[model samples]
Target: MATLLLTGASGLVGSRLLPRLVEAGHTCRALVRSEVALPDGTTGVRGDLADPDALRQAVEGVEAVVHLAALFRTTDEDAVWRANLDGTRNLITAVQTYAPRARFFMASTGNVYDAAAAQPGRETDTCSPTAAYPASKLAAEALLADSGLTWSVVRLPFVYGEGDGHLASMPGLVDRFGLHPAHTYSVAHHRDVATVVGMALAGTFDGRVVNLTDDAPVTVYEMAAFAGQPIDGSSEPLVNPWAGRMDSTVLRGFGFRPAVPTMQAAARDGIL
Candidate 1:
């Protein structure tokens, strides 16, 4: 059992993940900017990512750091950079000073991959993201890599399940991205995210950038229908067939297996 400092505890993923970590016997200290109800047994450290003194207090004596705070789907580019890039830099500095031995786990996005790639995004792919959110995350990844801390980066795809409504939001995203009905994208369930975090605690993902997703990559049309919010169907050829897909070979090689393996399975089990 390790003591962990977790940022973004109130976010979609972090809120769900904290309870699982507590249940797993790890002592979780959540860094929060405001008063929020945390999981039972979690210690809330009052601070945002920009506060250096607060970051120092948060990381001190922790065995690991789980960074899940990031800004996306916003029109404000400056806020995205401040939260994703500048925040990461500050956290890295704090960990380097206060908890140098702690392992770091950063949650990144699969959107960092080039939109026009011919195949699913791989860890070693050359990424050139034009969007602010992904660009900032990619830059943060570089900072962590060079920070010389034992770190792991997981590029998450479309995360859904546990009634987070992330899947339900896809119909509008389909229209926003101009994707064909047949365009497939990778996704992961909240439970499977907990599973990956467990792996990080066990030192299975150190010094690696892995893609996390379910076994089957599903199409947007199917996902929308499954969510009972179907988008307009299309037979036109997809311009970017591989836009939101990712290669999960590295995760598989690490013996990672998702608890929720498919969105259809999730729907059938009433977990979606």
Candidate 2:
């Protein structure tokens, strides 16, 4: 069993991952900014991601680290930079100083690629992150690479499951905006995401950028139909499109396959 330190344990992915890791007979520790209830046997450390000293304390003695704490978006670019870029630098530095040999896994978004690009984006594709979220993630990936630690970066597509507010709640958006059927995107279940991370922590893959996504792609109109909601024709143009279909061959080679496909089924099963 390995001692794993997870940042952002209060978030959707981390919360799901913690229980799974425990069930797998691994000891888990979480670093959080505030006091929160955690499962028995799980340790919690109160600290900010920007503080290198606090981050070192959280990472100390763990065999592996999963860095998932990141700000998705912000009105101010400076806040985005500090939270995503500087915070990642702090964490990387702490890992280097306090736990140099520990394996590091980072969660990145597929938005780092240009949305208008062709389908099935490969790991080697040049990144063109137009938005703040992807830009920060790309920057963090670079920082981690330079840290001289064994690291794996998972560039995730839209992840949905129970408690997933963004992708899971899209059916309501379709209803409200009256969207169309042509808007399509790829997605993976939250459990699948956790499973991929588990594989990474287990040292199944090394120094690779794997894409975590499902085998099939689904459109918003189909999702609305699955939810038994009316597909409106008016809100088609306002939809923000995803990057593109992602190639998951690397992840599949590691024995990671998504259990759920369509967002509709994920929502129906309460998985998203």
Candidate 3:
């Protein structure tokens, strides 16, 4: 089993993923800014991604790194860039110096795609994100590509499940952002994320950028209804129908299958 260093161990995704990684028989170490309880057998290092010494200690002797930390849903552009881009650079540099041979896996977002795309966002698509969060994540991806490290990036769509309340928050976000009710969005369950990362840990996705999503895309109206916060329906023509959809052909070709294939399946299984 490989020794792994995981950043963002206390966040939504990381908190759920750490236990799975530990259960997979890997020794896990988490880098955190403060005291936080982590999965048993997973060590927590008190440090920030901006600190070189802390990162150096985190990466030392680790065989893999899963980067799940990111700044999302914030108005502070500088904080977003610093945490997403600059912090990624710090971690990459530390890993390069301390554990050059380690495999690196970073969690990215599907929002990096252009909003007016004619088709589902594919790995081969030219991304020109207008939002701060996705733009910062794209910039971070570029930095990792040039770092000369063995790395892979998984672009995640709307992630939900394990009582994260991400799905339940859709109505509020739609109202605040004036989102089109008919606009379809791709989604992935937290368990599916664990599956993809498990494959990455086994070196199945080395040197690749894979988009992770379920079998079907769901509309905002449906999501809002599912969350028990139904919103007004709009019959007006949708401007960005494919805005949140992603093509997961690359991931499928790698023999990846989402355990929770759709949001409905998650609901039926009582996992959402």
lDDT of model 2 at position 169: 61
| Ranked by TM-score, top first | 3, 1, 2
Write down the RMSD of candidate 1 (Cα, Å). 1.0
Off by over 4 Å in 1: none
Instruction: Summarize candidate 3's per-residue lDDT along 1-272 as a digit string, tens digits.
Output: 79999998988899999999999999999999999988899998888988888999999999999999999868999999999999999999999999999999999999999988999999999998878899999999999988899999999999999888888999999979999899899999999999999998888978999999999999999999888889999999999788899999999999999899999988889898
lDDT of each: 0.93, 0.79, 0.93
Kindly indicate the candidate among 2 and 3 with the higher TM-score: 3
Which portions of model 2 show Cα errors greater than 4 Å? 171-181, 225-230, 234-242, 261-270
TM-score of candidate 1 against the unseen true structure? 0.97
Q: What value does the lDDT take at residue 143 in candidate 2?
A: 88
TM-score of 3: 0.98
